[model samples]
Target: AREVGMPLKMARAVQVGGPAWHWANFAKVARNFEWEKKVGNSVVVREAVGVVGCITPWNFPLSQITLKIAPAMAAGCTVVLKPSEIAPVNAMILAEIIHDAGVPAGVFNLVNGTGPVVGEVLGTHPQVDMVSFTGSTGAGKRVSELASQSVKRVTLELGGKSASVILDDANFEAAVKGTVSACMLNSGQTCSAHTRMLVPASRYEEVRALAQAAVARFSIGPSLDEASKLGPLVSAAQRDRVLNFIRIGIAEGADVIAGGPDTPATGKGYFVQPTVLGIKASDTLAQEEIFGPVLVVIPYRDEEDAVTIANNTIYGLGGAVWSASDEHAVKVARRIRTGQIDINGGPFNGSAPFGGYKQSGNGRENGIYGFEEFLEFKAMQFKPSAG
Candidate 1:
């Protein structure tokens, strides 16, 4: 909690819950070897992708590291990790734990340094067979460029501006509350947070009221404070960036329905108000990732218009759709272009596949899908002697 100013509960998601979930997945599940089969005179086998290079971001210091390393280990692939310098301590502690657990010295190596020093080398190194990265879209693009020099296999999980679509049939109160809580999680620093809310134009005024009321329930303070539901952002730069986005949103015609770019009353920590914006689909606030406790609510004409507005972005990471019927909710969710979406405030399933699509990112994490990212197909052939 103290490491990144994350609330204790949110911090636990990385410090404890993440490792536990990945380990449980391994210990409880049965491996599927059905893909190893014969065709003609050859048999196909799944082999490790060899040395994997993992470049993780600071927002999820430990969880992202585990997400990459655990599956790499399960697939019999060695790893070289470059954890974000902004949040480096937990990774070092994890390395020590691995060493004490008697993992071979070279099997898992930790090199703590800046992105240029460690991340770039890992991307272009001849010996590194694959590179897995999580960060901004710009950084991910740089990683891909460097990895291309070595023909390195790459997986990226980057930024998001996901939408929460509230259909007319959905229980308005429940959906609005759920969306607000989800957006403010980790103070909206999460890569896949549902930062955008889409509502029917007919009910726009009604939703704005609901959204304001929902967000009013959040109490911002120090991570350790018992009264605090939302914590300060990671750093000064992060705080400024978020506030700037808020300002830009307003300049570009977004209305500040709840909180604006104003400084918080705390007068100390790097804090920005937990804000909500009323905006159009084309507004920069609705399209780009603000990456803080900011939500942009947009109004759409109809169901089809809602889906179109939801997908009208450079990102396709995560989103949510609410409706009276599960089938109807899913039908809308299917139309949105994203990696994952929730149906009527469905709980996050840690074991399910998670990642992004489009500029948001490429590849998957979590469950067997993530495990496959570290594997490669190889066919062993033998010529038959006169049978």
Candidate 2:
């Protein structure tokens, strides 16, 4: 809690206990997969992709590291990790744990530095067989370009400007409240957070009011304070980046219904107010990943417009759709070009696939799909002995 203002309760969950749980899950899944198969006169087999370069983001520092490292190790691939400089302590602690657990020294290595200096090497290194990265879209693009030089396998889970679609027939209050809560989770630092909200135009006024109410309920304070519901951004630069996005929204004539582009009263830390903006799909706020407790509610004329708005972003990471019927919501969800979408505020499923589409980045993470990213396939052919 003290190191970076991670919520007191969530600090343990995110840094310590959560990583532990995920590591065990990764181990379990790793052991259960079939390594080889026989077809006709041939046997096909899976092998480690050799050395893997893992570049993780700071938002869910430990958890993201665990996601990349666990599966890479499970696939029998050696790893070289470069954690975000902003929250590198967790990676150090995790290294200690790995050392204590007696993992071979060469199997895993940690290098700490800025993305430009260290990340570039990981992406371009010829010895590294694969690279898995999680961060901004711009950075991911650079990673891809560098990795392409060596023809290395690359999997990226990058930025998102996901939307929360509330159908006219859905539970309006529940959906609005849930969307606001999700947008503010981790103080909105999450890459997959639903930062945009799409609702029927007829209910714009109602949604505005509901969104305002929900924003008011969030209490910002020092992370250790029991009453605090939100905390500071990871660094001052990040805080300024989010505030700049909010300012752009204002200049673009978007409605600031909840919070504004002002620094919070808690002057010491990088705190942005839990804000909600009413805007059109073309507004900057509706398209960018502000990475703060900010939400943009863009009204849609109908179901078609809602789907159109949801798919308008350069990102296609995560999203949500709410409807009276589960089938209706699922139907709408299928049309949205996102990696994952919540139905009626469904909970995050670690066991399911996660990642993105389009500029949000390529490849899936989590579950068996993530484990497969670090493996290569080979086939051996032989004639049958018996005629």
Candidate 3:
């Protein structure tokens, strides 16, 4: 908990993949196979792609590695795992568990080093058939470029500047609270955090007040504390980066309704106060990914304006739509151009394909879609019997 500032209960519940769920996902790969009955005497089959290079990020270290390694191994592809050095202890422990599980030695391997050395080699290696990477957009682009040299398949789960659109007819209190939670979860280090919130222009002050109050309710303290709803960021650099964004948000003329650029009184870890800012829809604070406990509220003129503001970013990762009617929320969600949008605080489903559009990178993860990333297709032809 101290190392990464994640609350113990939350970390324990989510960070490590439980035995049954992990095995269940492995079993899912078996179901990925299909028998095709074509008009002619031909059959199509899916086969293991080949060796896979899995580069996972520091956030949710064990889960990210498991998401890649389990599916790849299940698909029959050998894996070379490279976990972020920032939070690699759990990854090392996971490797021990996999080893104890009796996976063949050559089937799985772990390499510990920086992105420039080990990561670059993995991406460019001709023998590596595919690379599944999760990290920053810049790093993902570099991986794509390097992997392109060998024409290897690449799947990237990159950064996101997601939005949470609050419709005029939605329950104001519930929507605001839900959006605040979505924004500040994991101290806003999440790639899919709803950092931007869109509300009707006429109700801007009302929404802002609710959002500010919700942010205030968040208890910021040491991660080990059961009362703490928010914790310090990952590293000194990340803390500095988030603080810089707060400064920029202020310079951009956004009103800091709650929290500020000042450091938390603890003066201990990389703690940033839970921040909420009210800004113009087109402001820089509304566009950039701060990767902190900073939420930007942007008021829209109407439903059309809300959708327009939601899709105005270069990123199209995750978002949410809140409305009194489910049909109306779904309709607005369909137009938002994001990869995934939660409707009225819908719970996240692990089986669903999770990914993004545009600069958020390509390809999906989770369930069968994730497993297929390690597989290739083949077709067999047979002559029709002559009677």
Candidate maximizing lDDT: 2
Encode model 1's per-residue lDDT on 1-387: one tens digit a residue.
676777786667655687778865843432643447788899998888999999999887788898899888878899999999999998999999999989988999999999988999999899999999999999999999999988999999999989999999999999999999889988899999999999988998889899899989988889877678888999999999999999999999887889998887875688888899998887788777888999999998899999999888889999999999999999999899999999999998877899988998889988888888888999999897696
- Candidate 1 regions off by >4 Å? 27-35, 383-387
Q: Model 3 segments beyond 4 Å from truth? A: 17-23, 29-39
- Candidate 3 versus truth, CA RMSD in Å, comes to 1.6
Candidate 2 runs further than 4 Å off: none
Q: Residue-wise lDDT of candidate 3 within 30-79, one digit each (tens)? A: 56555244646877777888999999988777778888888888888999
* Top model number, TM-score: 2
The order by descending lDDT is 2, 1, 3
Which residue pairs collide, candidate 2? none
How does candidate 2 score on lDDT? 0.90
- Ranking of candidates on TM-score, top first: 2, 3, 1
Q: Kindly provide the TM-score of model 2 when superposed on the true structure, using C-alpha atoms.
A: 0.98
Worst 10 residues of 3 by lDDT: 30-39
